[model samples]
Target: MDMKLSGATFRRAASTVTVIGGSGFIGRNLHRALRSVGARPHVFTRRKPFAHAGRVHPAVAKSDTIFYVAGSVTPALAERNPELVEEDHWNLNLLLWGLRETGHRPLVVLASSGGTVYDPDAAPPYREDSPTRPVAAYGAAKLAQEHALAAADWTTPVILRFANVYGPGQTASAGYGVIPHWIRAVHARETLTMIGASRRDYVHIDDATAALLAVRAHADRLRATPGPTTLNIGSGAPTSLDELHRHLERAVGGPVEVRREPARSFDRTDTWLDVSAAGAALGWSPAIGLAEGLAGTLAATRHTSMSP
Candidate 1:
């Protein structure tokens, strides 16, 4: 999807925007995109940990919108160390308190997880109104943040339950992005590891960023709505491990090695999203298909590997 937003539209949407956790994967990309479109973006990293409300108050005081992308742990990591979950909640409360102290009720957009925040046994293609039964600590933490935002009447909350988002610049971290990890493994001629027969709905980073911009552009309507707006952001298509392997091989122009492992206790068998509401609400839909996105990511991975 195109990253450029019309100047007139941005002017109408917001002037000063604050991105918490601006150094992370999604936040970094969103920060760059916001700059490209001529919005004044203020970034607050986790380096300081937002310990003092005085420090965060100024950053969000006059902002028209705030994107909360801050979180300490992934699902797998959170499972190992559940203490991080409490820390995550505390950090958000600090941000909320800062906003309250400043008396600024900006449109707050939260980056939530669609993969972990749904009932695993309910059904596939979970919707915004679907029952939330987070099996892991990470999912529970995200849901807690959602509840916090919903309870904060001063701010307009827009919770985006994002499916697995992968694209260029995503690092090959453990328990993070399978696509990037597999692509890196292919480049290095290493074995691609598969866990069980899990399937996931992957959305491109461009599409994810576009969805955030769409929320920003629709800030007025969202604020005018009765309550907090929660929407799913994903491709709405599930791809199994075998299917992803085929696509990756095609993208790289060769076959790669593979190794299968037993599924972890925390892993869900399948996860897809029903993104129709996000489409209807924000006029947004996933533009990059899995194959196309994989190919682009492969090219990027190759370039990055060769870079000095």
Candidate 2:
């Protein structure tokens, strides 16, 4: 899984691109990669939300490809404030409306949730066609978004259900990534919160970015086929909370404190994805192992802390 593409490959894919929500963890990395590879990318951030007015609609109208990575709520946030979920769905509808009004048929790639969208009872390593039964509002909203894209016959949709993605540039915050939260806790010498013996498939940001580019490169092939193309993007391996704690301890050269908590009713016990379809379709697989990725992230966190 050497996830490197030459500039010529990207140039051949598309001349113009639009990245909705380009300020977030995944979008920031994807936007930078596209620019580095000589692709023209227009970004829309939360500070300036996309709307029918102004330059937003125009950018969406003329894009050769569009990456919809805009999301406002995490599982915890969604559970606490369900109204945000409705707002998210409304925003997506607005985008779809703009595309239809302009008659723009671009390749639209959606970043979905693989960790929450699968049925908790139906075994691990869920596939694209696996039974979807989201226990939380976040997963339900994502599934709704997927359905909306699938129904929109005007644009070509490529739905990517991603596993728990973590790497450099991800910061610790409420209702955000668990890995970063734990890393911050470890650095601050605080107790790492363990909820319900949860296990998940964590993919590095670099690998996730590579998969997005692969989809872009093969956009023409995807558009030619009928209906929306759905795929799972992940490492296809599961890691437990205890395993991750040990990895972090080894990286920092000390024992990390731990605190146990009962699992929330909305949480899933364990989940991972079967990413063989992505490998076969896009010729992409996760290259970074968990231990290696975690070590690199810990080093970056240290550097960030030491900086002025």
Candidate 3:
């Protein structure tokens, strides 16, 4: 919604950072923010990973930070296709091995899923110490990814379990990103489908980027913190599907038709994260309100649709 850094700039610990999926929603936003702060981020995508290095072996060379934001599928997709989910796990392991082979001891920041990485039976405001009982393949994969990173003793791992992060650069396709999907539908003057009554804690993209940077800035401090530290990045405010619809209506300046459907087995109800750990650890807290974030998203969507 605003400039990521917002005038207060700090020196980066690393000269260059490596983003595994630099072109994706979060990755792209983080990449832009890092550039604004005068840091070089070597982005690795499937098409252009080793273009400059000539091979995969040297791709991670000289990078001081590795931000792992790439993933293969949505939660629903992963649930329907366990084979593909397993394939993604193996692929992530291969990338980890490659990083190890390069002998680069970078601070590894894994972008975990806060939405699916916990037990549905657990109470609201999920803490870092909460038990993880993933009901979907996507959450299982994220938990597995966190474990895989932990096993790599050569690197320092910092996991950020992000909540429902939505903003301008998000997409409605691929059966995920509900907020952006609904915004896109509203922008097109189409009916908004509501599948089950569920509540989620949404963190704006600007706040998400700020949290990532805070982790990078406080890398050493987090490493010194006793146990396997994983902070939940969320707004700490739970918004129900109905409330979200009202926000969308206000953002779009009209009432959108709603078609209610049965809740899917993969969806969680009344889930939000306890952001205290992040505030305590990284000195970060979400500043944008739900209404403001939704308006910003709608404006960005309109700008994109009218472009070109």
Task: Report the candidate with higher lDDT, 1 versus 3.
Answer: 1
- For all candidates in order, the CA lDDT equals 0.87, 0.87, 0.81
Indicate whether candidate 2 or candidate 3 has the larger TM-score. 2
Residue 148 of model 2 has an lDDT of 97
Count of clashing residue pairs in every prediction: 0, 0, 0
Q: Could you tell me every candidate's TM-score relative to the true structure?
A: 0.96, 0.95, 0.92
Ten contiguous residues with the weakest lDDT in model 3 = 50-59
Rank by TM-score, highest first: 1, 2, 3
Report the CA-based lDDT of candidate 2 relative to the real structure.
0.87
TM-score of 1: 0.96
Q: List the residue pairs that clash in candidate 2.
A: none
Off by over 4 Å in 1: 4-8, 48-55
Residue-by-residue lDDT tens digits, candidate 1, 17-113: 8898888889999988887777768888877454463356565767888999988788788899878888888888777777775565689899999
How are the candidates ranked when ordered by lDDT, highest leading? Answer: 2, 1, 3
Off by over 4 Å in 2: 1-3, 6-8, 11-14, 53-56
